[model samples]
Target: MRVRVLRVLDVGGLPRVFWWVWVSTLVARTGAFVAPFLSYYLTRSLGHSAAFAGFVAALNAGGAAVSAVVGGVLADRVGRRGTLLGALVASAVTLVALGSVHSVGLIAVLAFLAGLANNATRPATGAIIADIVPSGDRGRAYALNYWAINLGFAVAMLSAGAVASHGYSLLFMGDAIANVGCAVVVFFTVPETRPTSVGVAGAGHAGQPERAGTLVDVLRDRIFLGFLGAVLVGAVIYSQAQTVQPIMMGQDGLGPGAYGAVAALNGILIGVLQLPMTSWMRRYTHGSVLAASSFLMGAGFAVPLLISAVGHPMGVYAGSVVVWTIAEIGSTPPQMALGADLAPAHLRGRYQGMSTLAWSVAGIVGPLVGGWALTAIGASAVLWASLLLGAAGVPAWVMLDRRSRTRVATLRAAEAHWEPVLSAIASPEVVSAGVPTSEPEPEPV
Candidate 1:
């Protein structure tokens, strides 16, 4: 039993730098107390309406959307390490400042800035994972990193209520400290993953030199854009738990502690079940897994409608959380892998940034609409809408899957285009970091 557990948890074969990145992600996510609770803080602490809270949360996500473009461009132009480090430091400063202020205008402005600074690190982080982990294990590597994120979230959720009870100052301060920890890890341990010489990093077919991509170039990709559209749909469904769940629970007479417990359940279930679920899901194609996840998430979000009939709020909420967490696990790894599979190495940062942008856009839309619906229309209405929205994406995913076989092959070849570049440029300071760089080598059968 112990051996089985070890086998499931072990990550010894990946590059050492990946561990540093994992550590940074773990430390950072463990302190993700602010964003999740921001809506609660607005309603309960600051005496704002749920609609206003949604607006602010949407505004924050808007900042993330803008940063997605800038951060991706910077990651490619400037370098991943520097962009990540600068973003983290800025995030820490912005988080602290946002926590210190009291004015409504200041809160909105700072929330936007905080979103920009905090989320700008994502493209760099995803690009780094793409850079270091071998091709065959990329899916599993992403799953492992996601596990670390959920594990940390579970830890944070466990203490968020207790800490918030002490004061939200402590919550923001703790979150800032965690950002600093992430920066320290990155500055010392995680090396630059983007190739210094553009020619060495992303040489193309027939000895042709590849050019740097513009946002236009990335947008020109119709298939990828369609995939992003699909991503936007799922992200909207996921964001409801953040934006509307608190308000729903609050109206139902559940406090922050109850919400925290419910949120914590999501993290715990994901931390425990993500890997095994991801492992089991390997047999399925990405389209099918994502399609099923969509339905599950829709069902999970709609479960809150059963509140009055169920009579046990926490039990119903916990059950809902379990369903949603499973949906999250099913969707995340494949989504990450497919995103990686679709982009060229040269535009990885931009591609990841665009992926993040989809989520950010969803963040803006989900809360803006969900919060309004919760306050104006009804919570049941908002949730039911999410189910329909999720269902709309199934055909899109299925169509994309049918078209993706050729694109994936092209992508694999593109990545292989970087192998000689990676081998030639490898060093302690440069990219690749000793992990196998290409997807051509078949995994052991």
Candidate 2:
């Protein structure tokens, strides 16, 4: 049992840089009190209506979506280390400024700026992980990062309620302080890892020069576009937990306490199980894992329909939460690793940014759609709708996985075809330099 526990905690092969990144991520997320309580602060403390608070929230999400793409471009252009430092520092300033503001307009503006800065860091961080960690270990690295995030969130959620009771200013100040600390950590520890280009003419096909492409270039990649679509669908399906589930439960006679308990259970399960499950899932292809996760999430959400037949058994709801939480644990790390794997060395930041964009877009669209569906067709239909969406996404992800495999195979074939020509070009220079000719090393399997 002790050995098994040790195995789960083992993160030995990943780079030292990743551990520091994980630490900073944990610190930042743990102190994230402002965003969670932003709606409450507007509605209760500032005496704004819930509708206004929601509008401000929507602005934040929209800013995040735009900033993610912009940040990705900046990370590739300026450097990951600098971009991350800028994002953290900007977020800290915004958070501090947000506390001092009383006008709803100013508060909303600061919230959007804060969201932009905070979300901008995500793609840069992801790109850095891909830059530093070996391809084979990326899944584990991302899993460990995800685990840290959930752990921080668990801590933050617990402390947020207590902090809110004190004042919204304290929450904003605390969050700002944490962001500053994260910035300091990155400034000191994380170095720039962006690949340097040798120039288009000098570098051959195998060693193509790294260059930042326009957003149109990213949009043109059909495989990536398909993957993004699948991700957007999955996010919308999973999002029902936040927007629709509680309402349904409340309508069925469940209290806030019951809903909070289930939500907490989801967080706890992911925090505890994500790393171990990620390690175990390394043996499977991304497609299989994603398909299974999508189906599980859909099935879990669909279980609410069974509640009507079961005479409103709470056990059915609880069981569904468990299933979906497990699915969450299974899906995140593999999906991130796959994104990194599919990205070119130069385009990693952009690819990750695009992936983040899918989630951000879903954050905006999902609640609106789910809320509308809930009112228009009722809860049961909404749940079934979520299930159908998940089912549709499974095939898209499966196709993405197949495309990724095909691309890897094509690259390998190209490398094999170019080997002899490269050797022929180099042989005369080698002879002139008095170096003995030998077989070239084989490419990584």
Candidate 3:
């Protein structure tokens, strides 16, 4: 057992994999930190409104949504490492352009472009991991992957806040620097995942036949589609908190330091606890674990609604954050693993890209909805809306549970159908090699 464990890690040493993923995430997410207080920066610093913040955020989301599919298709065709490198370089160039621009319209366009590049990194990086790691180890791989992303963003966020306190120019400078660093590391260190067509054909595995399907055929698979719907709703609610929570907590009297502290807590929790959570939850079906955790994540978002004290809501928010953080640790790895499972040998890049798109859709809607809720009703209304959306997510999760079961059954049936042919071939090879082929005498009927 120990030997098997050592062998798997040796196949891709955790440290080596960790460094590549960590640096990539740090660079990509650091650019993301450029937008840390963007809504506030735009409104308070550049003289905009809550409405303008939503518009800019929505524009970014739209860019991400479109790019998700485009990125996936490109990753499938171009290779994951190249796609990632391209996005990073593009992001860096665009951020430099953004720093030079003064017009809101141009900034909006630049923000969308930056968002396109930023969101594209997700699927490309994810597909690379899928290519390198064994199926059984994917859960831990993704856990570590998520940790890298969050930790990088956590540090970037703190730095961005500090930089912005000095000036927007400094923030942009920092963001651009990080993105350049990201591109450089990825260019030098990360190897391209072997092209799908060549690798699958070379292996001549039976699973190769199923890899012939295009993106449409893969997306149309009923079981996979159902899981996508569940994730879409959960993502929408979960993403809103990124913008909405800051506004609500700011109203509750927390300053930048408090906000940074909470964000750090989130990062620290995932970094420290994610591996243990993956190890402990390995026995559960991916769908069951993801759905349950989604429910918990939604519930955690709802918890802040009960706080009335502007002075004390930070504590309430922190405790609730811990709950959701735990849920995040549980749900994220299984969610990523199941997504990779949905594609066969050839379509891993596209499917993973589509998953990023699914999240992008949420990213687009989440903040806009929060802004609308706060404008029409109040800040508290946003929390209530989150509760409703979260409740709706439960049934979608139930559907995911059913769909996951069906997918497993289908894979089993396919395997069982092919086993006899495989056994016959194996038996012949054994006999040809002068080995006992496990022949059994026929009994009288």
Of the two candidates 2 and 3, the one with more favorable TM-score, higher being better, is: 2
Task: Give stretches of model 2 more than 4 Å off.
Answer: 1-6, 197-210, 409-445
Candidate 1 local lDDT, residue 288: 88
Which window of 10 residues has the lowest lDDT sum in candidate 1? Answer: 436-445
Reference-based lDDT, residue 310, model 2: 83
Q: Report RMSD (Å) for each prediction in the order shown.
A: 5.6, 8.0, 9.8
Q: Once superposed on the true structure, which residue ranges of model 1 sit more than 4 Å away at CA?
A: 1-6, 10-12, 37-58, 102-106, 161-168, 196-206, 246-257, 304-314, 374-380, 420-445
Error of 2 at 337 (Å): 0.9
What lDDT does each candidate get? 0.80, 0.78, 0.69
Candidate 1 contains a number of clashing pairs equal to 0
Estimate the lDDT of model 3: 0.69
The candidate that wins on lDDT is: 1
- TM-score of the candidate numbered 2? 0.89
Model 3: ten consecutive residues of lowest lDDT: 436-445
Estimated TM-score for each candidate: 0.85, 0.89, 0.80
- Which prediction has more favorable lDDT, 1 or 3? 1
Predictions ranked by lDDT, top down? 1, 2, 3
